[model samples]
Target: MKAVRYTLISGMLLLGMVFMKPTVVVSQCAMCSLNAENSTQHGNTQGKGLNNGILFLLGAPFLIGAGIGILWYKKYRTKSPKQTLLSHHS
Candidate 1:
């Protein structure tokens, strides 16, 4: 029960952080920055798209990992009485 409550609160905080993020997240390495700057200077939208795409890709893994972690916790949290007793004995 405590774990469930903590998980819910943590999930909500993560979501809030995600949703309230800054608009222009500069996620460029040296080479990437050079490329994006070159493209944007010529009025191409691809640079902006690239930056946003990178941001999205960066966030995807964390979200997936979080989901998998939540699922794993839910699955393993429900121990049978026998299993609980065995663990406690050890």
Candidate 2:
């Protein structure tokens, strides 16, 4: 069952990566978008940097949450029934 779950997750991740588009999505407020556009129009390369920064910022929370979740899973899932019994009896 664990192997099946791992295989399924791996397949889904592989499929998502295969189908994912390599498009830049800058998630910012309207004013920020306008400012970025204006800067780009003025021949400044700051807009690209801003976009990359936004992507990094946007990804940080999800990465952190995933790390926390994996840690929690490892802590809870690694204990066998025999280990639990032995620990409690000591």
Largest TM-score belongs to which candidate? 2
C-alpha TM-scores of all predictions: 0.58, 0.64
TM-score of 2: 0.64
Which regions of candidate 2 are displaced past 4 Å? 1-15, 18-22, 78-90
Q: Output the lDDT of residue 25, model 2.
A: 68
lDDT of each: 0.87, 0.86
Query: Which candidate tops lDDT?
Result: 1
Single out the weakest 10-residue window by summed lDDT for candidate 2. Answer: 77-86
- Give Cα distance to truth, residue 41, candidate 1, Å: 1.4
Q: Write the per-residue lDDT of candidate 2 for residues 19-64, one digit (tens) a residue.
A: 8967756588798889999999999998888888888888889999
Would you list the clashing residue pairs of candidate 1? Answer: none
